[model samples]
Each structure stands twice: as structure tokens, then as C-alpha cells.
Target: MTLRHAVLAALLDGDMSGYQLAKTFDVSVSNYWHALPQQLYGELTKLEKEGLITGRVVIQQGRPNKRLFSLADPGTETLTQFITEPSRPSFIRDDLLVKVRACEVGGHAELIEQLEERAVQARAKITLFDKLLRELRGGTDEETYLASNSRIGPYLTGLRGRAFETETLLWCEQSARVLRLRIGSKPANG
Candidate 1:
């Protein structure tokens, strides 16, 4: 998906300045679509020019004025059209995965180190997703919230992110353990 679609989906949360949108992306949206602040700003400008989004200037007492954006009718229509279209399948293109594939040829130590590092990152993300999911559900239990909440899209996506990270953590830990065990079997001077 394009940054345009990600930005549009984010605006569904509410009106937000570019800064606020960047923060939102860092916290929640980054789980799916990754974009730098500059890219997001550029996409916001393009969306506004295309009439997909509207922005209003908010004046602050001491700081610089900010522009808050909201999705327009055309944006909503665009999203509807997008959702109806078939999505291309996603493929893994990670460097670590490539390294793991080559690990059988050698470099087990490096691969094991990278895998352990990835596991740490995954754990951090899982913690963050857990906190976000809790906040999204408020005091309601997940099942109750899923069934009764007015807005469930974000929550559902958050669940996917959490699950993805959980799998990542598990795989990384298992791979690292296997690699570490294999290290003991290597020849003394080979």
C-alpha cells in the first residue's frame, strides 16, 4: 500500500497536525506501513492538493502554527475503492532471513547474534502493542470491546501487529538457540 493510503487511514482517528500524525505512525501505524516524517509530510501535501484531505491552520500562543488534517469525502471514497480491490500478496525480504538461509554455509555466530538482537526488538514491540491494545479497549474486555466498540479497525490491526511480533520473537529465540547448539558441533580448527 502507498503512503497515501496509510495517511488516509490514520486521519480516520481524528484531525491531527503533521507532527501528531507522525507520532501516531511511530506508535501504531508503523506496525504495518513504515514511512519517515518527510515522506508523510509530502504525502499530506499531495493529498491536500488532490482534494482527498483538508487541512486547517491552528495558531498557538508561543510555538509555530500547525496544520491539522482531516479526510475529505473523496478520501473516504478512495479508501472504499481501495478496500474493494484485491491486494497483492506480501513476501518476506528481510536481510536477517537471507543471512539465516546462508548460515548453513557458515557465519553461524553472526546469524545467532543478529537473531538474538531481533528477538529483543520484537519483545519491545510486543510490549508497546500490548499497551496500545489496552488503551484502545479502555476498561472493556477485548471480547466485549470487539463485539461492542464503534471503531474496531484500529484494534483489529493492533491485534495483528501484536501477533506478528509475538511470532517474530518466538522464531528468533528458537533460531538463535539452534544456532548456538550447532556452534558446539563445529570442528576445532575447521
Candidate 2:
């Protein structure tokens, strides 16, 4: 899907300034859609020009005036159309998988380090997701949250993120194990 669609869908929550949108994207939309803040700003302007979004300038005391953006009716219609239409297949272009695949063939010191870093980052994200889930469910207890499903979105997304992190950690651990074994079996000169 186009970045425009992602921006429009995000606006569905409510009007927000560019800065707020950036933060929201990092927390909520990062799982399925990834875009730089600069790209978001560019898309906002383009959407405004296309009459898909409207921005209202707000006066500020210290910093520059902020423009709060909201999805226009046309934008909502466009998003509905986009969602209904068959989506294009997702493309996979990831570095971590490639590094893991090559871990045993060559020097894996850097790759292993990077994998460790990714695992850390993934755990951090899972923690954040869990916090959001707790807030959504209104409690820390799993049974309580399960019984009350008022906030289903974050709960479901959090579970998905947690599962993804677990998978990533497992992959990293297995890669490290295999690489160490290979290193131990191979001769120093070989």
C-alpha cells in the first residue's frame, strides 16, 4: 500500500500535529508501516494539495506554529476504496534474515553483534507493546484483560508483537549457537 494510505488511516484516530503524528506512528503504526518523519511531512503536504487532507494552523508561543492535520471526506473515501481493493503482495527486503543465513559461511562477529542488538530492540518494543496492552485492558492481570475486551486493538497487536519478538530472539539464539559450533569445528587456518 502507498504511504498516503497509511497516513490517511492514521488520521482516522483524530486530528494531530506533525510532531504528534510522528510519535503516534512510532508507537502504533511501526509494526505494519514504517516511514521517516520527513516522509510523513512530505506526504502530509502532498495530501493537502490533493484535497485528501486539511491542515489548520495553530499559533504557538515559543516554537513555530503547528498545523494540525485531519483526513478530509475524500481522503476517508479513498482509504475505504483502498482497503476494499485487493492488496498487492508484500515484498520482503530485510537485512537480519540475510545476515542469519550467512552466519556460518564467513566472519559472523559483526552479524552476531547486530543480531544481539536487534533482539534487544525487539524486546524493548515488546515491553512497550505490553504496557500499551495493559493500559488498554485496564489491568496487569491477563485473565482480567481477557475477560474484558474493551480495547481489542492494542491487545491483539501487543500479542502479535510479543510473538514476533519471541521468534526473533529464538532465531538470534539459534544463529549464535550454530555459528559457535561451526567456529569450534573449523581449523584456525581453514
Candidate 3:
């Protein structure tokens, strides 16, 4: 999917300044789609020019003016159409995966280190996603929140993010363990 679609979908929540959009993407959208702040700013300009998103300048004392953006009619229509289109299947293109595939040739130590590092990263994200999900649910249990909340898209995506990280942590640990075993070495920290 294009960044256009991601930006449009993000604006679905409400009007947001470019900075706010960037923060939102960093916390939530980064789960499914990744974009740098500069990329988001550029796409915002393009979307505004194309009339897919509406932007209004907000003046503030002691600060530069900021443009707040919201989804226009065309933007909503674009997102709707995008939703109806078949999504291309997602695939892994991770460099770590490639290295693991070739591990038999050499570099078991490096590969194991990389895998353990990835596991740590995944654990961090899982903790973050857990906190985010709790905040999104707002003291409600997941079932109740899902049933009662109208704006559950973010929560749903956060759930997916947590699950993804959890799986990543598991896979990384498993891969590391297998490599260590093959090399007749004890697992890291054990």
C-alpha cells in the first residue's frame, strides 16, 4: 500500500498537525506501515495539493504556524476504494532471515548475536505495545472495549502489533537456541 493510503487512514481519527501525524505513526501506524517524519511531511503536501486532504494553517504565538490536516471527501473516497482492493501478500525481506538461511556456511557467532539482539528488540516493542493497548482500552477490558468503542481501528492494529512482536521474540529466541545447539554451545545467559 502507498503512504498516501496510510496518511489518509491516519487522518481518519481526527484533524492533526504534521507533527501530530508523525507521532501517531511512530506509536501506532509504524506497526503496519513505516514512514519517516520528512516522508510524512512530503506526502502531506502532495495529498493537500491533490485535494485528498485539507490543510489549514494554525497560528500560535511564540511558535511557527503549523498546518493541521484532515481527510477530505476525496481522501475518504480514496481510502474506501483502497479498502476494496485486494492487498498484496506481505512477505519477509529481513536481512537477518537471509543471514540465517546461509548460516551453515559460517558466522554462527555473528548470526546468534544478531538473533539475540533482534529478540531483545522484539521484547521491547511487545512491552511498548502492551502499554499502548492498555492506554487505548482506557480501563476497559479488551472484550468490553471492542464491543463498546466506535474507534477501535487503532486498538485493533495495536493488538496486531503486539502479536507480531510476541511472535518475533519467540522466533528469534528459538532460532538462536537452534544455532547454539548446532554449534555445541550453551544458550546465551544459560
Stronger candidate by lDDT (2 vs 3): 3
lDDT of 2 at 151: 40
lDDT of 2 by residue, 1-190 (tens): 8899889988977899988889978997777789999999999999999999999999999999989999999999999899799988866578888877766577676666676677678778878877777776664577767777554554666688678777877777667656756666432223
How many backbone clashes can be found in candidate 3? 0
Work out the TM-score per prediction.
Answer: 0.95, 0.82, 0.95
What's the count of clashing pairs in each model shown?
A: 0, 0, 0
Q: Give the TM-score of candidate 2.
A: 0.82
Regions of model 2 farther than 4 Å from truth? 139-158, 185-190
**Top model by lDDT, which number?**
3
RMSD of each: 3.6, 4.4, 1.3
Task: Give the clash count for model 1.
Answer: 0
Compared with the true structure, all predictions reach lDDT values of: 0.91, 0.79, 0.93
Which parts of model 3 are misplaced by more than 4 Å?
Answer: none
Question: Whole-model lDDT for model 3 versus the true structure?
Answer: 0.93
